[model samples]
Target chain A: MSPSPPQLSPKELSAYFAFTEVSSLLRHSVEKQLKDAGQLSYVQFQLLARLGDAPGGSQRMTDLADGVVYSRSGLTYQVQLLEQRGLVTRAPSPEDERSTIATITDDGRGVLATVFPGHIATVKDLLFDSLTADDIEGLERVLTQVSAHLRANPPRSAGSRKKS
Target chain B: MSPSPPQLSPKELSAYFAFTEVSSLLRHSVEKQLKDAGQLSYVQFQLLARLGDAPGGSQRMTDLADGVVYSRSGLTYQVQLLEQRGLVTRAPSPEDERSTIATITDDGRGVLATVFPGHIATVKDLLFDSLTADDIEGLERVLTQVSAHLRANPPRSAGSRKKS
Candidate 1:
């Protein structure tokens, strides 16, 4: 016999529903903004944003996948697309030939600068506008705790992928 | 010159990052579980779940799209796939011949029964485990507020789509 489904309290169920609903709505709004403002997908925006924020404006492809919680092959495809668009370039890492590093180009930074205003506005209008300061604080605290727990057993982390 | 980007305070920035990261991670985990346990995509599972929850195990195709925050074309394709799987049936509504109504089949309910244990457990492990009761309360409150605001100007609501 199959295991019994776990019971969730009414409050827990409503919370989960609300959380997923808001995430879906907010993501949709931001994705539309990114597409309109810079013709970038959310994943592409995340890739460029992460690389742009890196200390040297670059990161290993594997690290990029881990940071964005994306699959390696999928990340490679996105990087290739970015490269074709002249927004980023990839090269073998000097310290480790097996690893590749991706660097955001000047064009990539330009795209970020282009889309950021609309992106920020969409986020602010859809999410932050409804939140009070206390709500924001609580959101940060709860999500940070949840993030740490999820990262501890990350599905796409280099260590996790090593086994597969 | 392009308008300057909206300024997000440091705390607000961190809160947004934490929210997106946790949602991504949680979604990834649940998607993996749904695939492993039932050969269902997250969207398919959502469709079935929504149908199951609706009165009489049915809903209008347009309403399904709006409720799921999915595009009309995309939702139609998913419904087709589910129909092919014998999990749902699409029929022209008697009251409105132009509109299609989707009804979940017994097989769809069976699939839900099969996959829900793992889905609930995944949600609990990846999300609820990280939260205190107070955190859950705060999460629900803040997210419910955000959802109401976003829904007010929803991008894919029937009224919005008519304009497009």
Candidate 2:
């Protein structure tokens, strides 16, 4: 076992607890909405939404995995599920025969359109409703800083390898 | 189809994106650490930690579910797993014979002690290292408000009934 680390400052512990608890609650709320409205899991919704927003309505599978922070094999299974549902289509990339590109199909767009209203409502009701504009700004600034730092120096345990 | 909702203000979108992304990355990082070092899933670790922190180091099973925002059946399963591992013990609540209480065992405390250093380091390295004192204070204040509001008006889709 590693030696005991120094105690976290009260501020650090309090801030972390609040951040984690809020994140968990928010995810639960969003996941329930997605499931109820679209029969979609949260990660599935994220993949569809990202593909819907991408240029030319498609992205390389590797890029999509990175964007969602999902492992390559895990993402492949998700994409396969979506393809079977006709919500997305995967094809070989034009520029690289070895790489695959995933595009949201018309069915995918329709599901997004159907689910968007409820999704937005849930987000607004559970998250934005309680946040003041100033609080939003502060959250954005702090989280952006923390995110960039973590992205650049990801934990070794995350196993986030970039596969081309 | 429902009518399109109004667009979120750019600030709202930006803030929510950062918040969600940060939350996701932090969870992945923490989960990896817990899995690697303690052979525990994130939710399992949460259950143990919360039980460890409760008064008398025990809490009603229903209360644990609410505190962790997990489904009743799901918490029951997790507690059963912990019990099999000798990390937690569940007994009928003395004050409420109809309810069960979960308590962390000495072995649970030992696992916590072993993994806590890595957990604290991961948190500090990924989250708090970049945050200023003011950022920490602001985050705690804003998230506390949001968490309370969401807890009071949780999403209908969560299906969080208090089962005795």
Here the TM-score of candidate 1's chain B is 0.92
Task: Give a tens-digit lDDT track for model 1, residues B13-41.
Answer: 88899889888888888888899788899
Return the clash pairs for model 1, or none: none
Q: Can you give the TM-score per candidate against the true fold? A: 0.93, 0.93
Q: For residue B149, what is the lDDT in candidate 2?
A: 88
Candidate 1 docking category? Answer: medium
Model 2 C-alpha lDDT per residue in residues A26-129, reported as the tens digit of each score: 88878877888899998899999999999878999999999998889999999998999999999999899999999999999999988888888777777878
Writing each residue's lDDT as its tens digit, candidate 2 over B1-164 gives 45657566777778788888889888888888899889899989999899889988899998998888777899999999999999999899888899998999999999987788999988888887888888888888888888788778866645735745
Name the docking class for model 2: medium
> Clash pairs of candidate 2?
none
The alpha-carbon lDDT assigned to residue A136 of candidate 1 equals 82
